[model samples]
Target: AMDDREVLLTRQEVTVAEHGDWAEVELYEAYQNQTWERQEVVYYFSLPESAVITGLWLGDSAERSERFAYRVSPRGAAQAVYRHEVRRRVDPALLEQIGPRQYRLRIFPVEPQRRDWDQDTNRMVVEDGPSLHMWLTYRVLIKIEEGGDVWPLPQLAEKRNVYWDDTSDRLVNGEPMAADEETWLPPAVPATSFVEPGIHRVDFPGGESVIARPASDEDLPAWPEDLHLAVVLDRSRSMAGRQAEVRAALAQLRRIADSDTVVDVYLTASEYHGEEPTLVELSWLDLGSITYAGGQNAAGLLAQFEALHAGQEYAAIFVFTDGSGYELGDGGFDVSVPGAPVWMVHLGDDLPLGYDDATLEAIQASGGGVAGDVREALTRLAVALEGEAYDVVDGYVWDVLPTEAADARDALDGDFAPFAARWLILAEMQRHRGEINELETLDYLHDVAVEYGVVTPYSSMIVLVNERQEKLLDELEARGDRFEREYERVGETEGQNALTVTGVPEPEEWLLLALAAVALALLYLYPRLSARGTLFTKVSHH
Candidate 1:
C-alpha cells in the first residue's frame, strides 16, 4: 500500500435498480494539470468529429458494434471536457458480467507537446519542454440495448446520473444497494431520460467530422411521403424478356422495402404500339393492379412489389426494356413526364437506336436520377427512393487499416466507383506545374503515386505530362508572355487558398534540343553518303 491514500476522482453506474447491480465504480488519477510533467499522464483517445452510432457496447470486444465501443477524438483536450448529457440504463446481468470496474484515466499527447519530468520524483508540478503541444480528451459511451430494435424500453430504465461524469458524484439519494468506503450505493436506479431525439448533433473537439441520426417517425431528407419515379428502358428486342436484367433490377427494389422507402417502377418499351409517347408517372396511366404472375405487365409488376412491402411509400416507377417503336410514326422511347422524373435504364448493349436526345434531356429535366449499369443503377435507386446514403467511413478509419477499416474498404470497393470520374482538378494542377520535367517529374510522380497508393510508378506518364507543359510554355514564351505561376483558379476561394503558381519556363530550350538532334543527323550525312554511293558504283562496276 502507498504511504498516502489516492483521492477518489468520480464514481457512478449506468443501469437501473431493477438489476440489483452494485457497482461502486471509483476512479483515482495521478493528476492532469497542464503544469504537470510528462509522466503525469498515461493514456490517450482519439475520435472523429461526428458519428451516427447505429450500434454500440461497453468496453472492447470482437463484435462489430459491441467491440471497442469507444470512439476517440483526434483533437486533444489538455483539460477534461465535461458532457453532462450522456445517460444510460442497463440490466443487472450486464453489470454482473462486467463486474465492479474502476477507471484510472490519463491523456497522452504526442510530440511538440511532451511534458518534462524529474526521473525519481513523482511530483505533480510542471516542467519545461522543448515545445508545447495541444491537448485532447476522449469520453466513454456506455451502451444500453434491449437486445433488439424496440427502443426506449420504459421498464428497463431503472435510474440514471442525470448529470454524470461532468462533476463529482453527489449523495446516492434515490435508493441504496451497497455500502462502499465513503458512501451508500444505489441499486443502479432507473431513470426516464433518453437521448434527445431528432437529429441531435455532437461537436468533436477539433471539428473535422459530422454525423446525422434520424428518427423513424420523421420524413427523410430529400424524400417525402409521396415518392416519385419514372422508368426508361431499352426496347431493342435483343433485351426482350431478357429476364436477367429485370430480375436484378427487381431484386434491388426489393431491398428498398427493408429500409421503409416507397418506389414506383415504370417499363419503357420502345416497341410497344400506340403509346407513341413521352415520359409520365405510371400511376396516372391506365394501368391496372399487378398480379406478378411471372409476366411483364406494368400493373402486375408493381402489385408484386406492393405485396412484398408493408404500407411503404410507392415513390417512382422505372421501365427498362429493349425494343424499337412498333411503327415508323411511333414515338418509341420518346416519352414526357413534366411533373415526375423518369429513370430510363437502357438494357443490353444498345440503348434505343437513334434515341432522341431531346426526349432524354426532357426526362432528365423532370428531375430524375439516372442509372447506367446494374451496380450503379441499383445504388442510385436506393439513394433516390430511400433518401439516404450508406454510412461509408462515417467514422475515422485512420491511416492504419484495422479489421473495421478493411471492412469499410471492402464495402466501399463496391460502393465507391472510382472509375466513374477522374480527378480532373488535381490532374490539371499536376499538369500545369511542369511537375513532370526530367528527374523533377520523377519526384512529382512519386508524390502522386504515394498519395494514390500506387506501388510501381510509371515514368512514361511523367515524361508525357512534362513534355506537354514544356510545349505550352514554349508557345507562351514565344508570345513574350509567361505566367506558369498563375493559372486562373476555377473558383475564387479555391484559387486563393489551394492553387498557387510560381514561374513559367520557356519551352524554346526543348525546341532547340529537337532541332539540334535533326541538324546532327543531317551533319554526318553528306560525306558518308558520297562515300557509300561511290562504293556502291564501284561494286556495280566490278
Candidate 2:
C-alpha cells in the first residue's frame, strides 16, 4: 500500500491533513468574467518575511530571495531569534534508502549546530516541542541540584508535581509541594533552615532537598495554603508596546498579594547567555532575599509566589499578555504555578496566530511538526500578538470560562449586561468544575458582586427583603429538636457525605455576601413565590 499522501518535513513523514486548495476547490467559468485575476489563485504556503511577494512559491523568482537566505536577530532581553534555511539538501544517493522512489529529502534543525534547547512554550512542556528561533544569550539561572548541584531539570517543574518533605505539609525546596498534604502526612516540625535567607544548600537530615531560596514571615504570621500564586509575563518585543497594561496588571496583582496573595513572577524572553535555554523568573518578590542589584532565579521567584499565597483561603493567577506563549525546551511551557484553583487573567484580543479567534488551543497545535516552524512560532507568533489579547471563550454559559473573573467582568456590560452578565459568570464557574454548589459557587460569584458594587444593600426594599429571608433561619431553628433526635452524633469524618436534609451550606465571607443578595431577591419575590414568609417552610424532612 503506497502512501502517496505522505510527505516528509524535516525528516519525519506526516499524512497530509485534509485542506482545500485551488486544486481541490471546484470552480467553473461564469460567462463574461472569464479573465482570471492574479488573486484568484489561493495559496496555502507560508512566506519568509510577511507582507509582499505574496502567494505560494510557484517557482524561483528574485523577489523570493528570502526563500534562499534568511537570518534572525534577538529583539529584547535574550529573546531567541530563529532563521530558516535548507540546513541540508537530500543526497541523491540516499533516495534508495527511502521507500518512495520519486524523491526523499532529509532536513534537520535550521541551526543544526545549536546546543541550546529549543522551546514551544505556548503549551505544556511534557508534550510539545521547542521553538526554532535562533539562540540568544540569557542570564545564568542556577537551581541547587541534589548533592552539590547534580543534574539540572530539563524543564521547570510544575508545583504540586515535585516534592521533598517527609510530610507533604512540610516545605519542598521550601514551598507547599503537595496539594493532598492534609490527608496524606501527619504534621511535623517547621524546618528553620527553610526560613533562613541565602543560597546555602543543606541536606534535610532524612528528607529530600529541592532547589529553593529561603524566605519566611518572621515578623508576621504564616501564609494560608490557599493564598499561593504564580504570575507569568511575556517579554517578547511585541509585548514592549503593551508593557503598561502588563505592569498595571502586575501592580494590581502585587497590591492583592500585599493583603493576602502570595505572588511570584516569571519573564520569558530569548535565552541570553544562560547555561540553559529557558524562560527566566527575574524577581523573587521575597523581601528577605534581596540581592544587591535585585534580580532572581526560578526557585527564588516561585518561593516568593508561594509565600504570597501562603495564608489566604482563596488563590488566583493573573497572566497579562497578548497571548503569544513561549517556545520552551521539550517544546512546551515550563509551568509550576499551583493553588486551590488557578485564575488566568489573559488580556486584550490579540492572538499568537495571525488569524482571528486564535487560541491557546490553536497555538499549542501550530507547530507544523517541523523544527523550524516550532522554533519560529516562539518569536514571530508575537507578530499577530502585538495587537490585543481577547478571551476566546465568549458567552458566559459556554462552560470553559476565562480564568480571571475581573477581566471577564471588564469585557462585560450593558442592560441585561449587569445581572445577566453575572449569571453568565456563575454559569462560567460551574462550567469549569461540576462540584460547585451554593457556598463554593457564591465565592466566585461574589467577585461579580463586588465589581458590580452590590457588596452592601442599597435600598430599603433590599433591607426589608434581607429581614424577611431571616424566616429561613427561624424555620431551620424550629427543626433543631427533630434534627438532633433523628441524627445521632457521627463516628468520624466518615458518613459526612450522607445525603440528607437539615444541612446548610456553611457560607464563607464571600458566600455570606451572596446570601445577603439572595435574601434581598427572595424578599422582593415574596409577593410572587411565597405570598408571605420564606423560601423554605417549617418542616423536618428527615
lDDT of each: 0.27, 0.24
The ten-residue window of minimal lDDT in model 2 covers: 92-101
Question: Residues 146-183, candidate 2, lDDT per residue (tens digit)?
Answer: 33321111111111111222321222233442324222
Residue-pair clashes, model 2: 50
Question: Which predicted model would earn the best TM-score?
Answer: 1
lDDT of 1 by residue, 109-156 (tens): 211122222223422222332211111111212123344211111011
Per-residue lDDT of 482 in model 2: 12
What's the C-alpha lDDT at position 8 in model 1?
Answer: 21
TM-score of each: 0.23, 0.23
* Candidate 2 error regions (>4 Å): 1-226, 273-317, 323-346, 354-542
Q: Please, what's the RMSD in Å of model 1? A: 28.4
